[model samples]
Target: MKRALITGVTGQDGSYLAEHLLRCGYEVWGLLRGQPSPHRSRISRIADDLKFVEGDLLDQSSLVAAVDRAQPDEVYNLAAISYVPMSWQQADLTGEVTGLGVLRMLEAIRMVSGIGRSGTTSMAGQIRFYQASSSEMFGKVREVPQNEDTALHPRSPYGVAKTYGHFITRNYRESFGLFAVSGILFNHESPRRGREFVTRKISRAAARISKGLQSELRLGNLDAVRDWGFAGDYVKAMHLMLQQGNPGDYVVGTGRTHSVRDAVRIAFETVGLDWSRHVVCDSRLVRPAEVDLLCADPKRARAQLGWEPTVDFDELVRMMVEADLERAEREQRDVARAPTEPEGDW
Candidate 1:
């Protein structure tokens, strides 16, 4: 079995990608910073099959050891400090993790060529690299339906860091003749989305409120738009990129956009509630630098990978809300015997 390594196994996309690669008959290994959380629910169906190894993106020594130990045929660099507003508070750390982290991984790969590291098993030419670039890189939206060729004007520190990761992937491919590809994925969500994000926060809170478990849901910038797609479908595009005869960057997303208000409406609509009554827009919740619009031009992915978003916006929202409701209802029903824990902290 070809070994596949993912850097962010705990994340939504990484979890889905692990499942996809495992189903494709690859032995999956994950690079994790620490041990698994006992309270956290895993989205990856093949969690038992995935081998997790401790590694840190900021540490070159750890990455080198991880690469050597995993000896992966393909490496997916999906780990990043991705939340935009949080990036403002942790700007420098975001740069270190999201931008320079890619550099550190690439350096580890290059060093495996027997250039710098002693007694390192070399497979630099054989390992394929996949970088999880984002549509956030096109922050402020110079042009609608942002494509691979679109000029980037990133508005947030998160976006700026992703842009660096994107170009660095290109640098590795061109300079080292390695099989490296960048997927400029737009906003893709699923049930596993971190509640810190607006969509999941909306759906989870709305579900709780419908169950009489919460008071109200707060949000900001309901007018900001995003081209959201299914995380499952986008993860397929990442795998497709590795299967291609030649490596190239591809834009992976649904070719449409929806306002944040639209998401709130759909999410609450799923719970059979009027969102206008419960959604309190707090001015403080707004990002200091907002990415006003994002729409994806996914023609290249369609043509190259024969890919299109399988789930539309309405269905996507429904799936998320339904999952939230299931989770909340189960929690309430089991409360008599179940051990109580604090709310999900990050």
Candidate 2:
């Protein structure tokens, strides 16, 4: 059976990708940074099927050890300081984990694959690599519906780091003949999304507000537009990229744009609530350098990998809202079952 190692295996995309790989009959192993949490409930479902290794992106030796232990034929580098706003506050940390981390992974692959030897006969040449590049790399887009050919003008440190990772993946493919490819993914969300992310925050708020547990939802730049797709659908494209005979970058998205306001409206509407009444625009939530719009031209991914988004914009919003609502209901039930303190009992 083919073996695959995934960094950031606890994340939303990582969980879905792990499940996908397992279903396809691959022996999947994941790199965990620390002790596992219940929050990784998505991957925890398939815990029996997954092999875990403790590692960190900041430590190159740990990554090399992970690559050695997993002995994977494919490595998916998804671990990074992914939060955009967090990147602003922790620019140096972002540069270390997101930017320098790619180089470390590539080096780890090289070490494990036995680089410096020539020809396809080498094991390193045989192992494939996939880097998760974000469409945020196209921040301050020169044009609408960015394709692979678009010049990267990243606005935030996070985007800048992803851009660096993208180029390095390409460099490894060209210079070392490693089967390394970068998937320039647009905004993709799912129920498993972290509450810190805007999409999930909105969905969670909508669910809670509908249940009368929340009074308001605060956000920034309601006009900032992004091309969103389903996380489940996008992970397929990542797998497809590695299956290809050639190693090349591809942009993946639904080729459509929607604003934060649009997302809020749909999310609230899904729960039968009016977003305008409950939503507030907080300037404090705005970014230092915002990426106003990011729409994708996913023709290359479609034509090359035979991949297209299965979930549309409306469907994605509804799915998140529904999932959050169910979660809220479960939590509420748990709270009701808990025994309360006997009226001021010492």
Candidate 3:
């Protein structure tokens, strides 16, 4: 079986990618920063199936150690300070982990694999690398639907960091002749998406409101548009990029756009509620420098990877809402099962 190492194995994309690789008969190793217990919930079904090694993006030595131990044929560097809002709050940390982190990983691979000055590796063999580049890199987009050729004008610290990662992956590929490819993925979401994201927030709130567990949903930038796809579908494109004859960048997206308002409406509709009744636009929730629109031109991914999104916007929204509804119902059941506290029992 092929051996593969994945960073950020607890994240939504990482969890889905791990499952995909496992199904394809790959022995997956996860590079984790600390104890695995806290992250087990994300990959509970396949936790035992994966090998975990402690590593931190901020620490190069740990990364080198993890890479040496895993000795993977392919490494997916998915670990990053991914939240955009958090990136602003912790810009320095984001730059360290997300921007410089890619460089550290590339260096580790170069050293461990014994890559020489002439772009050749020793007996250890060449390791294929995939850097998770974001659509946010194309902030203040120059084109209507961004493709591989579009110029990057990153707005947030996260976007700037991702841009650095993207270029560094290509730099390693050119300088050391490493099989490195960057997937410029658009905004993909799943039931596993964190609540901090707008889509998941909408889905969770819609479900809770339907269950009478929540009354209001605060949001910002209802006009902001993004090309969203299913995380499972996008991960397939990531894997397919490595299987290709040539290493190159590709934009992976649904090639369709949706607004925050549209997402709210669809999510609420899925849960049998009207979004306007609950959703309140909060100015404080808005980004310091907002990216108004982002849409992908994924023709290359379709032709090269033979990939297209299976889940549409409606289906994705419904799926997340339904999942949240089930969770809410379970919570209600657990609360009901709890014994009542006796008054003045002390």
Candidate 4:
């Protein structure tokens, strides 16, 4: 079986990608910064199926060690300080892990493969690399729908860092003859999405309010729009990028845009709750520099990769809301089952 190494294996995309690769008969190795037990929840179903390699993006030596140990046929670097708002709060950390981290991985691969050396042949046995670039790179978009050729004008520190990672991935491909490709993926969500993200936040809150567990949902600009796709579908594009004859950047998205308000409405409706009753606009939740709109021109991904999103916006929202509702119900059941203190003081 082919061996593959995945960084950020605990994240939504990483978990989906790991499951995908495993189903394809690839022996997957996940890069873990610390103890594996703490991060097992995301990939618990496939945790035992994966080999964990201890490493961190902040440290080059650890990455080199990971590469040496895994000796993977393909490497997917998905680890990043992915939250856009958090990027502002921890700009330096984001730069270190998200920006410079790509460089370290590339260098590690170069050292391990030795493909770019004077006597070494470039095509022999080199690990293919995929950097998870973001649509946020098109902060102040120059066009209606962005594609691979779109110019990057990153606004947040996260987007700026992702831009650096994107360029450096291409640079290594050209300068060092590495098989490196960057996928400029648009906003993709799943039931596993963290609550910090708007889509998940809306879904979880809708579920909680429906269950009488939460009182209100505070959100930022409800008009901000994004091109969203299912995480499972996008991860397929990542694998497809590596299987191609040539290495190049590709934009992966659903080609459909939805606003934050649209997501809220769909999610609340899924839970049989009126969103307006519980949803409240909080100015403090707004970004320091907001990206009003982001939609993808995914013609390249469709025509080239033979890929299309199976889940639409409505389906995606309902999926998440239903998942959260199930969780809330489970929690309620557990609370009811727990033992209570005796009526009399003990």
* Total clashing pairs for each candidate: 0, 0, 0, 0
Q: Sorted on TM-score, highest at the top, how do the candidates line up?
A: 3, 4, 2, 1
Alpha-carbon RMSD, candidate 2 = 1.8
lDDT of 1 by residue, 223-342 (tens): 999999889999999999998888899999888889999999998888889998998989998888788889889999999999878999999999999999998998778876777787
- Regions more than 4 Å wrong, model 3: 121-124
Residue-level lDDT for 60 in candidate 2: 94
Between the candidate structures 1 and 2, which one is better when assessed by TM-score? 2
lDDT of 2 by residue, 1-346 (tens): 9999999889999999999999999999989988756567878789899999978889999989989899998999998889899999999999999999999999898888877645243333377999999999999999887999999999999999999999988888777788999999999999999999999999999999988788999999999999999999999999999898778999999999999999999999999988999999999999988899899999999998999889999999999999999998987898889999788856
User: Please, what is the TM-score per model?
Assistant: 0.92, 0.96, 0.97, 0.96
- How good is model 1 by TM-score? 0.92
* Tens-digit lDDT track of model 3 for 31-82: 9889644555889999899999999998999999999999999999999999
Worst 10 residues of 3 by lDDT: 117-126
Worst 10 residues of 1 by lDDT: 115-124
Off by over 4 Å in 2: 117-125, 344-346
